[model samples]
Target: MTQPDLSVLDDHFSAMTWGWVGDRGTWTTDAARASLDALEQLGCSWIVLAYATLQATPQSTRIDYAAAPTLTDDEVRWGIRESRRRGWKICLKPVVNVANGTWRGFIGFFDQDVPGEPTWAEWFASYTDYIVHHARIAEEEGVELFVIGCEMVMTDGREAEWRALIERVREVYSGLVTYNCDKYQEDRLTWWDAVDVISASGYYPTGEWPRQLDRIEPVVRRHGKPFLFIEAGCPSRDTSPQRPNDWTLEGAPSGQAQADYLDEMFTACAARDWVGGFALWDWPAALYNPADAAANTDYCMYAKPGEAIVRDYYASRRSG
Candidate 1:
């Protein structure tokens, strides 16, 4: 794939990064607000707020999306308004398969279509309606970007349906629309043309840093459009591995190693004339953030020593 010229997103990438706030739809209003403030201090220029889930629980399923407290239009509006007030962009991403970890927390869908399960059509229909509602909320809140789904690998074969759903989203969301695919699901890249930008979650292992982007850059450039790292995170100081996939926050090197890896990746991306902006997977450590609270020392660096390196690197960028 040829690399798309991304000079367009240069300003956005100057000091930009992807901020992970965990499932906001699962948090209290006060918590979400506080988290946003903390993220701002960490230099988060954009946020991908998760809004849905996989299980049929009261917390994840919203009967009246407009009024649902955790993710109602009011809450979304609050986030966007605050972001704009602080000069930031909000990318509202309502996902599925959150609780049951379906498709690695991308398309939070249950096996709702099989026997003794909710039908896929029923779940998809509801999710589509939910996405429409989110679009309306984005309009009201001035949210610039909205993501329909993230990481639905098993169900990617249903490309036709996904395309139609994106078209419908276009009818409501005047701003950019995109979906979040996992690292390897390049097959579905073409289906995202309806979106203003093509996006992927780049959580390839820490060791895969610069090389990870190198591998993806060629393909992304071929798409000839702006790209976004919809999701990303680095490990903390003391996290162990549960299992090793392509990427993980567990049992990696030290915070310095993580920082060096990110610096190399960001520098490489910045040097690229074709690549657009990139959002780091997360924010610097803070007291209240889940990664800080649970002490999951692997991925998701909130207040690790690696932060000093990141802060200094950007500071240098600002100086030069």
Candidate 2:
């Protein structure tokens, strides 16, 4: 396959913003359509479609290799069509471990008979097939990008295998490729050779966020490559602490507090040379209503202050 240069950030690079798709879980075609409508209205150029469920069964893992998920294909296709219709880009990112740790089998990894947890190789071999299967579809469907993995902290060290998998994927698809990593593991990852961009799920506090990155500049300079903050999240509406000294905003009670923090981060990133782009951790307001919403706190970007932050940032980049 001819490898085309896919560097989205360059001197002529324009600013682009994307949000995490709302966590509506599984839905019928109608619900999915409604969700797409809502996201398009928000001016999202790219969307991360999630298909993993809280209780995915073993049978679910046997998704047809040739096509996207059948149940929500309409929703998936609607997202693709509408995004293309509006000149937007869509990337399919099916997250595993949504059930905390239970549904791993459904997404293909360890069998129920296995005792403790399955080995990383066991998971990667199976999961990468699923990812590549869908990725090939994204390629045919003309989607903008495709994610191979997300937040699988347990399997981060299998570098050689990951590189091989990405190289194989490159043969079938000619679009951007990346694996989303937890922020702390940014430097630990070694599979960059086969990937187009280095991405991480990172979130920072409200003040001088990029300043925290000064410590990593020497390491990054050594890599001689630009990085994307592919996933960074802050609580859009919460004033209380979720994690100790967590990056959540302080003093600002309204949703706007969250937006302000994200705005600061985007400004800091876009004005720099090393930072390519930032994908806000999530949008569509799921933080507040995660499954078992009453028991869990919310972290999504719906009507919250962070929503405006995204809108304004994109506007600034577009106009700049």
Candidate 3:
């Protein structure tokens, strides 16, 4: 395999997560190529190839793909190769989700051993295997960055276990590494010094960008590590800006609302010199009807007004 060049890391990253599942062909198809082309036109300098693992609960000591569809290992390698071939840097983010529909943020274990209840040691043992498997792949594929986990809020308190997991990851992967902490949890991480960068989900309300940035600044300053939003976006629905993190919020479709939210987020972060960049929440593995874009109320920016806002902002950064 040809090693991907990491020189692009010095630039501000305008990225999108190509969230996909099912099979190897999904990434190698013509639609995938077209999606990558669209992303390039949107001025994306980086692409996050996100995959998922499954566990029955936070305490379950097994991480496997039997419960849900996931991209095959071969498909992920092809994705990295294809994205780099298009001149985009790559961040391999292997996330975990519970099989019972619980959010990963709720994954947790008792601090002390409890009989009949799974132990933190057991859970971390399985999680380590899940993460290290991808880390080795990231290293072999020359992925420019590796994100160990995403929004595992309850487990963040177990700093020792996470740090140990990071140590294990470093043994196999040689690249910048970071964890995607949930929004508002950034300052709580005392172990930021262990990773190459500090990252969090940037799903702040449209009106609260400045205040949230104020709260986050001290953490970034104290750690002296570069910071960026690993996941952030609002749905194209009425009132979505006020509750940008809630994907299930109900309302009529409102493209302008989503566009305005993106504009506000980009403007605020652009003013903060310490903020590095962002990888928008997602773009889909399969696109929907272009004609129905107005009726679509998801976070996807495809053929929507928010897409142009993101493109213009990212293009300006590249040009400036």
Candidate 4:
């Protein structure tokens, strides 16, 4: 397959991270359309159609993607079409998360499979099914990018499995494929060569962007592949700048803090041209009232100072 290039980023390389494993068939609602309308106003060029399925536990092998909590296949297709209709570039990101209150990064089995116990083989089979299912939809809809997986830290070490999964997806979905590694784990992925693009979650502290980028730079340069911060953004709280990855951090809602963190992020990434683009952490399918943005403290950029920060940054990068 011929690889796609970073020219896709052109000037403004940004996406409004939308969809979070939306409720069963809730994707095409009027509220969802309204949210997309608002996102359109932000000037982001891409829409990350991020959705997820759940495994019963960190050790569970079955990926129950058809469960009631997830969007049905119809909804997922509608979402892809809706975003395409809005003239946004699409990056279909299908994620697997663990239930049972455990972080998905802990989802793993022993290095060696034991009888009657779950094995990496079992998990990869299910995970590959979940990803390829969406990858086919991406191909049919002309999605420009396809992310095979997201932040599954425990599975990142299985380079051969990941490479095989990419091959499986390629057999059905012909598009640029990338994987989202957990923060600070860029160099850990020895199989970056298996995918067309390299991406990681960029949740380093406001002050740590320079150092983290320095660490990630050589990895991309060595592989000669485009890199993106496929998942990046800070929450609306003062404590977040120091640890943006901690979504549950306690602090008063401070949109300025989120704005400052992203402003610094945009500035730092500007110096690293290889830092091809970003898909900010998220926007909700059901948007909150803009009037309440100051008090609301999640990752949504609506009506917050970060919204303008993004708008300005995206606007600045465009060719008139």
Candidate 5:
């Protein structure tokens, strides 16, 4: 999991994230480019360009990354090229998803081999190919940081496979590498030494920020590696701050609710030096109309008051 030092990625990664831009040709469009430009103006020092590649089920051994649902490799490269050109570090994170409408965290197999049943060995082989494919692109495009996997909870216990996958990635990507474990998993993983940095989804509920950081900080210190939240944000929905990880929660859209969450999040995190900055959940490939910001309930911060909260927080990090 070790690789060449990429000092360029050492700064507080004030990353504004764009995740799961699933459409095939979306990144090549002017709208996508304008979106990236807008993200840069938020005082962001890093950009997280994430996409999802699909498999048929959680137990499916085959990962079909080149399927029509994912962005083309050329689109990924353009994103990396455009982000670096703007003087922003790019974290190219490609995630695995289940096409059967299940969460990726549930992807798993039997602990012991069962004849005719899918095996972890089979899954890791395909998954490794999927990651190595993107790792090569990250290397070619000079991406500052690359996330090898995201929120694969059931697979976290397979330490050896993860180490091997990260080792393969290290051979291709010369820059920093990290694996994005699910929220609350910072202390659960035993293989932090397998990657250059430690990262996880930071989706703790409201009022629990300090407690969770207290829990996660020791893990980072114990491993002696840098840490960051590869994914974190609240939806405009009123219920979001209480369960920032639940996008499906029902509530009226309120930008102030989102801003309040970010305010508390940044204030709490600001006190902890080891808690590196975030890559917010998303800013869409095709932005919504600005006037409709209050009505939009999903996590995209475009034109929302929360965007201002992020801008001010990131700006303070630069000037302070």
Candidate 6:
């Protein structure tokens, strides 16, 4: 299939990340429309649609989510079509989770093959299948971009496998491709040349955006690839800025803190021309009541002070 025109992606993309959960039926509901409408009102120019698959453990390769209660293939297609209809650029992000409750970043294998144990070879094979399945879908649907994987820290050292996976994805996906490295791991990816863009999770601590950006700048320059924060946001908790990546951090809800963190992040990133833009950590498939914003303390910026900050920032970029 011929790829859709994606020249529009050259500009800065203020994206709102959207992830689905629960049964597939929810994708076609009024709730989904309301959520997208809310995001569009926030002035997002792009939507990063993340679909998750699961494995029993980092060492286990059996990747399957279609059979689970998560979002279905039809739901994903609907999301893509809806995003396009709303004039938002689409980045299809296929993520893998561990069913046994391990974070994907901790997914690792022995340095060398071990007898009678699950090996890196087995893991990569399953991972490749999971990624390529969505790559083909992204191609068929003409998504503007495709994210090969998200924050597979332990597996990142398998340079040969990652490069080969990118090559295979290229055969099916005609759009730009990228991998979302975990925070502080941007420089560790030696195979940067294999991907079209350099992206990482921007979960640096509060007041440390400059230091992190400085650390990342040389890598972007060296690789000569456009840079973006594929995922970044602080929860609406008092101390979230100090550890933005920790979603479970406890504290009273503080929209002001979240808003301030976003302000700092946008200001820091905007000053650097190489920093393309951000796809904020997420907006949910289902939204909570706007009236309850003060009590809620997750990363979702909807109906909070952070939401306004994001709107202003994105609107400023659009007008500028």
lDDT of every predicted structure (CA atoms): 0.56, 0.56, 0.85, 0.88, 0.88, 0.87
Candidate 2 backbone overlaps, count: 7
Worst 10 residues of 6 by lDDT: 1-10
| Structural RMSD, model 1 | 5.7
Model 1 gets an lDDT of 0.56
lDDT of 5 by residue, 1-320 (tens): 34468466565779878746556888878888888777777988888988888899899999888888888898888888888889887888998888898999999999999999999999999999999999999988888789999999999999999999988888888888899999999999999988888999999999999999999988988888888998999999999999999989999899999999999999999999987778888888888888998899989888999999999998888887
Candidate 6 lDDT by residue in tens digits, 244-267: 999888898999999999999999
Error of 2 at 276 (Å): 1.6
> Between which residue pairs do clashes occur in model 6?
none
lDDT of 1 by residue, 1-320 (tens): 11223332345543333323333353435655565566565554555555543443412433344443335555556656766777766677766544443333343336434565545565557767877777778767766677887776755666666787877787776677777787766544557565567777665654455566667776667767677666644554333211122243345345555565566556666666555455555542133444443444454445666566556655555554
TM-score of each: 0.74, 0.74, 0.94, 0.97, 0.97, 0.96
Q: Is candidate 3 or candidate 4 better by lDDT?
A: 4
Per candidate, the number of residue pairs that clash is 26, 7, 0, 0, 0, 0
Q: Candidate 2 on 1-320: residue-level lDDT in tens?
A: 66645643432222222223323434434544454455554555455654542323432333332333232445555556655666555666655543344433234444233556544465556666767766777777876567787766655766776887787788788878878776566777776666776776656566646665674455467676657666765654456223212543453444555556666677767666777566554543122332333232245555555566777666665666
How big is the RMSD of model 4? 1.3
Off by more than 4 A, model 4: 1-11
The residue pairs in collision within model 2 are 255-305, 256-305, 259-306, 287-298, 287-299, 287-300, 288-298
Better of 2 and 5 by lDDT: 5
Pitting candidate 1 against candidate 5, the one with the higher TM-score is 5
Per-candidate Cα RMSD to the true structure, in Å, reads: 5.7, 6.0, 2.6, 1.3, 1.3, 1.7
